[model samples]
Target: MSEATGWPFWVMVVAFIAIGMGTSCMYLGAVATCAKNYGKGKHKGIMLAVPIAAFGLSGMWQSQLGTYVLYERKVDGSRGDVDVFRYFLFLGILLFVIGVIGTFALRIVDDEEEEYIDRTVEDLERSGLLEESEFFRPRHEIQAAYGTFNADAEEGSVTLSEEERQQRKRDLEREEEERRKKNWLLNYETRIFLQDPTMWWLAAGFFLVTGPGESFINNLGTVIPTLTPRSYAAAAPPAGLPSTHVTTIALTSTIARLLTGTLSDFFAPVETHLFPPIPEDRRRARLEAEQANRPTLSRMVFLLPSALILSCGYLLLSTPLPLIDPPLLHLTTALVGFGYGGAFSLTPIIISVVWGTENFATNWGIVAMMPALGAALWGVIYSTAYQRAVNSGSGFADGQCHGWSCYGLWAVTSTISVWIAVGVWLAAWRGWKKRGIVV
Candidate 1:
């Protein structure tokens, strides 16, 4: 249910624009509010805005596409899932726009001769800077080279005498010393942990499991007993019932984002409240100790637990609920959808946790490409197989129409997904082993 899953092209165009406008407005409004109250640079304004923008894009597109799918399926009985073009297009547009906007936005406050002033920020007197800055606000690209804006040191426009410079040099070195000690865990905090090999294997396993769960889990409606000419066991969902298939994934992911968003917001405050008065260093140490209990590597832990929930949900959906029109089949797909959303939301960022940010797009793109391909190819293989076997009378479920065709399709798709996952994990593991990141 990404724009990548494609709905109607015309409808999607409209959805994209509307979502973009709404998302931009909401983001800008919040940023404006933050600037008015707490100020933007230090208020996490950029970080907060980007994700919200992402939500609008995905949410609107998914809704539009889902509606179109429902309409199409009802009109012609097809789920008409499209390629991953929307994902790529939206992503490219997002990054390009952000990068461009950032470039220009920065130019609005541009300064060229300020190199002299800028130099005061990064250097400690020990590192041979001319003097310590009286203004302790940060100056270098606001965010630690890894993030967005950081407060710039605004050195008052004043010249210093030789004696003032020397004394300030001493002061700067002392300031640098205290700064380092104050946030000793800054590096560790900014960086994600990836010490264990087993965790990567777990991540790959999750990826493998999701391949099937994503593409064909809700698909049983179009499949399974559909193997028979019109197996009446599960009444064909009323005309437009199957249409939900179009937006099911998108809707599911949207819900997951909402849930994750709520939890993430809640936890931040809770953590801050619990350690309201703890010394910064001690709090850092304590947090590290807690995370040690559940290795950051095991972030896949969420996926593992969710996967089982999804499987059960899918199973239930497979069993028709008497009152439900499409049966629980469509609704239960939510479990799988949530898991996929969680994985989709987390995986790329998680990969960067170990691989570093040097080429994050390349690293994540490759991971994403494989699954996208797997889902797509597996889908066509499944669709075509069932069609052929049903026609030949040797397809699926003991030749009860074409059951085996679906099995054959799963067999091949699963095999391919497993191989892709294994290859990625092994390569990552070997790289880490040789690099000796563990030490």
Candidate 2:
């Protein structure tokens, strides 16, 4: 490519990284906004699922499009693709256009405060305070309680003395403090969330489950050689294409995400009742406390089926495939995809359940880092194991790997690791059941 077209390799690397960062930042902000605004609604899971499913499915779309755009047939009937640069350029332009359109089209207007205000107003009226003329008087408790929305305040502007202005500022500050107190469970000191053992346990579970799934997806191209005939392994797209595997995985993942997220809503009624209820007298005091951090629980048990599926996927992969025809490798990939997508879809809801949504963006960011950590660690394990297997076998010189021997150890390790993650999740679930905390 460099000989034919004066393109530097380093420039492509730089452009790729820069574009990736920009796109990731856009999605992060957009997804966080969606979570914060609609995190509590009936269709909350589906709303969150759409963005994640798009991200999971994009890999297949990009792979197919790039293959179509870059493929070229030579006179000798071998591959002669030289349009790699063009393929990336097309993808970049498409992303830019979509990002621009989405930026203008999407918005999140949070009206959560309005719900809080209505509740407070109803409480005041029920207590017979609203009927008192003194409640509307200047410097009254109700006036201060409502702050800027004080209905008794004059419509016309009026100048105020320095002392009066200071008093008004104090009242506004007091109002904010009261609101925070009322919604205490929705707020937490970062230190408290950090100190919680459950957060780390969840991260550990993420580290375990996500590592194997990521490793499977990332190593699909390499593993395909062992699962198919030699000629097919060496062939490009439209012939002996391994992209079918990629497409299958992506399709299953997208479907799983949409289905699981939507179905979780149906179980919400049964699942929410499992939590311990607040005492009548303690409810108001709890809400009014400085640190009203509660042990949050969720319908995370809904994810058990997905986790079991992942276990089965890894078990299949761990089995030797010398007779590839006997067992379909694509089925394993699809199972992994389904499990991965379900886990990804459920994590946000779980986070919102375990940790209050008041600081969701920050909490999710912390929780999300576990996957990357897992990926880095397990990627090395899988790749290193495969390389060792290849080196021990007779095909090292020609760069040809044979049979399930290549990934057997990697698969075994991954299978065990995923089940361990399942155990950890179960422990957390039991904790939630007993104490309303994920522990």
Candidate 3:
């Protein structure tokens, strides 16, 4: 293997990155649903726990498999500081084939299935339930809101059991007929989520995420000590708790994700429940009665609490914890965890509303790239700053400056976070404006 094929180190990373990203996406979808379902008061927390807990436990298998493959390469002498085109080429081709097969094998909802689901839900609602059952669909169909609702309702019945069955069938037929008369696809509300608000916004967001991720993804592990550093030789957590580094990284991230996942569920209804026009039938009545209420901005009203928490977290995290003992440090880390978690939870809903989910997969995928870029940026920020400060030649090397890695990373992270916060507030304001709900 030559430089043309590049470092085997990089090849391995790319492969693992694909694996990591795919894993992350799987996790994101699962965890976010926990939030969505939980927020909507539909499902229990078990759905979210199954993935994280299972992943945490089963992680060893994937880890071992990954390690085994790498070790085999080493033993076979393919693991020099050089490249093995043959190895990577084979791996790449295998992955590509697997990808192709998996790609088309997936069946998104066809028109008929969607129509059937819509009608079923509408029937359930119109028969005086006053609302669709939150868990209308089973687990499998819940992804796209398609599934069965094994339910029936009625008052007391006289004799005539056979006639009652026939009559019930007739009632279902009547509901279907009524639903068919309404072509919901033409209904704008149904289509809102699918729309990508702005091409430039999505594109910018992607690069924003990717630039930092690519540039500095692994830097934090060195300074912050979290999860498994790409470099495994460092150390594992103590039996009592993971290593400081592992705990720092994993605890924050794990807690952040857990809390954020749930919080997003809490806020999702707000994101999707937008009937900006107040519905045509209710517009006049709402407007006439609305004059008495105090006018306020949506961003200020809706996001204020989360924003304040985020601000306090930001202000405090930069300062050292007055930890006489170890417990305070962990508690401080948890507070940081809350800030990070809240932002992660809220940002998606903001994006979903700002852009719509029409092309949301792509939209989110792009925006998601920003954190990567941010990480990358922080990596560069740390590495360069640390080197420069050490060489500044002012004899200013102090113990406080001994570990500037976290500080450097945080400097860049906090700066970017400020911008992200602004973007979030702007999104909320804009979302309300679009709906005529707030300024």
Candidate 4:
């Protein structure tokens, strides 16, 4: 397709559409699968983070390949044009092999396996060996304290009659049925999730925060040239400068994802009551007591710093210092990359924690769509600014404007957008707090 000059624009559009669809499906499927398999464990955050961090790191290697291996060399020893045909062929074969391997390797834990694991956990909890473990809550204590089990019975010696055992079995079956129902499309839980104001606020925050980062990435090549000295404006950008920034962003983004995922696991509050059998009046008190004792942080706390870091990047780009020495632009990308990567990684974990892994794909899909809108909005703003600068009679060469004026407006606009996102996230945080949701 890269070498087919006869192909129509519509054909190219269809090819792009196909690529986009496949990429989205594969990315979301991998994330949802990880969440389903590991979401109940203590390391759920890091488990989810691994695939997300991999997604960020992918850009680094791919860009490096395109720069160092897939490009033509000029007589002067500088890199020339890219070999788009070979690059496309390489990507196609690489993705095909990965897909083939994934088909055999990506198996979810089966129902029997999950049940056995649950039983083992219950046995350990009952044995009192896990009493000191923060991740496990003793089932026997919960049953006795909630009056589901006989309080008079001895701790490790409680027995159930045949009728009581049958009733307990029926209760478990009913709970399982309800859980399946909640996972169904357009169910009660889905309706509640859609109707919740907090969900929209969270989505809006993601849109505002991620859109600027997306735009910055898409425009990086163009923006870098703008920061070049007028004498060098007509010359090719410092060889590999843009690629270096791309790698920097990718690396920092990957690191941010890993760090945030691990930190969230360590600090975020754990849900104590998976299936609360108590009366509604007493449940709030129980939750309060559990939370007070645990004193875990909310996942929402991570978003504030992420947004601020992103805003700082935008603010830096809007300044004149980067034009004086364009290499200094690395700091901007690093900040934006860290903030962007952390926010993106945290979104899925938050959804899995608050809504649950069962409906995670649908919930995350809804939220994920917001970034495209944000990217388009910022992209347009950025293009308009660049075009205006190009036509400003500023002695810019090759239709490219030099200095801060070229990108300053878009950067300022993005900074404002990120701050607005911070406010939106705070609103979502308050909403979750009001409803006693940990995330």
Candidate 5:
């Protein structure tokens, strides 16, 4: 639709909206499915990371394709113009083919099969027929059931008294009710999730930190030209430079996603406290069992460093340094890419870990929407600064803003925003730690 030469403005607007909606739906579906399927495994973090990394990687290759194949070459062998019609058509066809393939290729394991495997493993472990190295139960489940086998063995047999049996039954009933509430729309669980102060802190922090990233990525093409020297004012900017930076960002983002995901799995602190509070004796046993394995680092630890790195990137961009003298713009993009990708990947993992994966889709959706507001806020600020520079006659004859005046204010504003986000995230991390809450 965008390729149509005579389409009304409203038609283009509608097409863009439809495309955005479809892309969002696909992203959410893919991530949620991975979270649901592999969220209980030992390598759940890495499992979840794969899809997110792929999301970043797709941008890198696609941008490269558009730059090399979709752009028209001039008679002098220089890149002349983008063939938007061909580019759009290629994307549409490629996406459609991939979507069709994914529809047939993607499969979630059946609950019954999962349950059977877990049950079989537990039975084997109980019979002392399974090696410790062969154990495959989720860490939490293993911790929860840690002392049961030993206790049964010590007693030769075990039996629950009538009162104890009644209590157990009540506990199971309550748990079932809670699960049902979580699944229901506008229920108690929804209210609790929304009312949680921690959730809002996370949302606010995400908004401040990620919004700048979104704005930067969207305006990168425009920003690059502003950094060009006056000597090149009469000439077109290097065609490959913007694409090179984009590819760099995308590549670094993918790596950051994978790195954070894998490291968090090995190092994130274990939460010994289970909700619905188990009996004190059992809880004590669980804690004792977990003490030997607890990691000192929290998953939240990753967020602070990411925010700081992103802030540094913004600060670098805000500087009046010439683009080529130091060739540091690539460094700026790398830091921003790493920070943005790490935070994006870690947020979902934190949600699943802290809130449980049973309602992850809803929780993630609410938190994820915050970046849109941030992006809009920063986008407006960036555009305003650029226009101000242009109006002040600090721009070229063609009305393009040049040098630091074009983007310095916007970068500084984003730097402050990201630093504030760092503070917010720090506060949340401290509060959670003080309360013995796992992030």
Candidate 6:
């Protein structure tokens, strides 16, 4: 297509990129808002999981709709006729409608902010559950309020001497005055988030897990039809195994998202809950002191299983034997789907956990691009390998590619790459553990 249009194809490319960016922004914005509203409450993982799960399930709905609605059967036994451009138009209109409706419906209530501040400290003292002095606020806010809350200090900065307290108040007022004149988007929280290494670690982990899954998703249509003998391809349904694989993936991925996110919340870090014997105020002080320096782990330990599951699936395809059978392909796709969902859902919640929710929208958006980077890299590998295989033999005819030999090496390489990604995440996990962090 690009060769035919030359420079003009760049217009289509740019438009597609713009569309992708727009959709991503909407998604991250919704997720961050939802996560922030629920982050301080119980079951935060499950609360944040629903939006991402919907994202996973949307692909299945789109696949089924496009298969039946966009393509018409020919008079002959084989299916041929398609109105792809019209189908895309329909999709665009549908998306626009959804976006409009969602914009109105997805409300993040701001009315409770004053109430939250008023009740938070009192409630913590009453219930003995508050972790830090500024557990609900951004770290920058905490710092600005009373300097660092040192555990061993004479009064830990919370009960500063009258003169010291007055100085701190003035400092906070000065900081607030400066903040009022600045853009909220480029605020201190965002600057702090950019400097954190844990964010990069999580994003890299996202890239590693999703890259091969994306490669599988993108190549499945080509892989499935071609894997079968040429005789079978002519008789297969227009929306046969490929569509089934994709839908199955989405379904499983959605399930994974819901289950994993909910489970993570149930397994909240011990530090978050109230411990007895110690006075409520003292416990709160200790909790705050601990939280001040450490990044919150978003129960990302839940994803270790997902990484292993995906690795197993990739291993199956990497084997020398042809995965020509539909049942086996469906099973593999389902596993991949689960991992895909887990990665997407968990990463956002993790970002919300580790990084303060003050700049979650921007932080999630920054990390979300890692999967795309992975996809682009793996896509190149799959494309090059498949093309080489096709060129080496008598080329494909009638939309049918012949043989498994083409994909075997690519599959193995992808499997190795995925395992390496798993290792990277494990390293991150170890680092967290070494720093006395819990996931």
What TM-score against the true fold does each predicted structure earn?
0.44, 0.74, 0.48, 0.79, 0.79, 0.75
Relative to the true structure, how large is the alpha-carbon lDDT of every model?
0.45, 0.67, 0.42, 0.77, 0.75, 0.69
Winner by lDDT: 4
Compose the digit string of candidate 5's lDDT tens values, residues 1-439: 5665686899889988887877776677778778778876667788888888898888898888887888888899887667888888998898788778777766666654334334433544565544553234454554355356445543653476657655664565445444433343224234556887777888899999999999998998788778776776434453227778789889988999999999888876554322222245655665566667774577888878878888999998888764554357778889899999998899888877766554567778889898788899999999999999999987987777887889899999999999999888888777666756665
Cand. 2 TM to true fold: 0.74
Give candidate 4 regions above 4 Å deviation: 1-5, 75-78, 112-186, 233-240, 272-295
Instruction: Indicate the worst ten consecutive residues by lDDT in candidate 2.
Output: 269-278
| lDDT over C-alpha atoms for residue 409 of model 4 | 94
Q: Which runs of model 3 end up more than 4 angstroms from their true locations?
A: 1-7, 28-113, 116-221, 224-242, 248-278, 282-317, 320-332, 349-360, 393-416, 419-427, 430-434, 437-439
lDDT tens per residue, model 1, 1-439: 6546646789979967776555444444433332223211222223332353354336456546544532323347555543346644655577568656644553212222133223322433334332443334464422244222111221431366657755665565556544543343223212223334534564565557566664664355454354333434433433123435435655776666455433332232112111012345655675677566543333333434444555555454333341234334455556656755655544543443344332233344445444544566567766666678777776445444433444455545554554455455555545544643320
Displacement of residue 31 (Cα, Å) in model 5 is 1.0
The C-alpha RMSD in Å for every predicted model, in order, reads 12.9, 8.6, 13.4, 11.0, 11.9, 10.4
Least lDDT summed over 10 consecutive residues: which range in candidate 6? 270-279
CA displacement after TM-score superposition, residue 284 of candidate 5 (Å): 4.9
Q: 229 in model 1: Cα distance from truth in Å?
A: 7.3
Clashing residue pairs, backbone N/CA/C < 3 A, model 4? none
* lDDT (Cα, 0-100) at 102 in candidate 4: 76
Against the true structure, candidate 3 reaches a TM-score of: 0.48
Global CA lDDT computed for model 4? 0.77
Model 3, 280-332: lDDT tens digits are: 44555654555445342232343334434444543443444321122333443
Rank list by lDDT: 4, 5, 6, 2, 1, 3
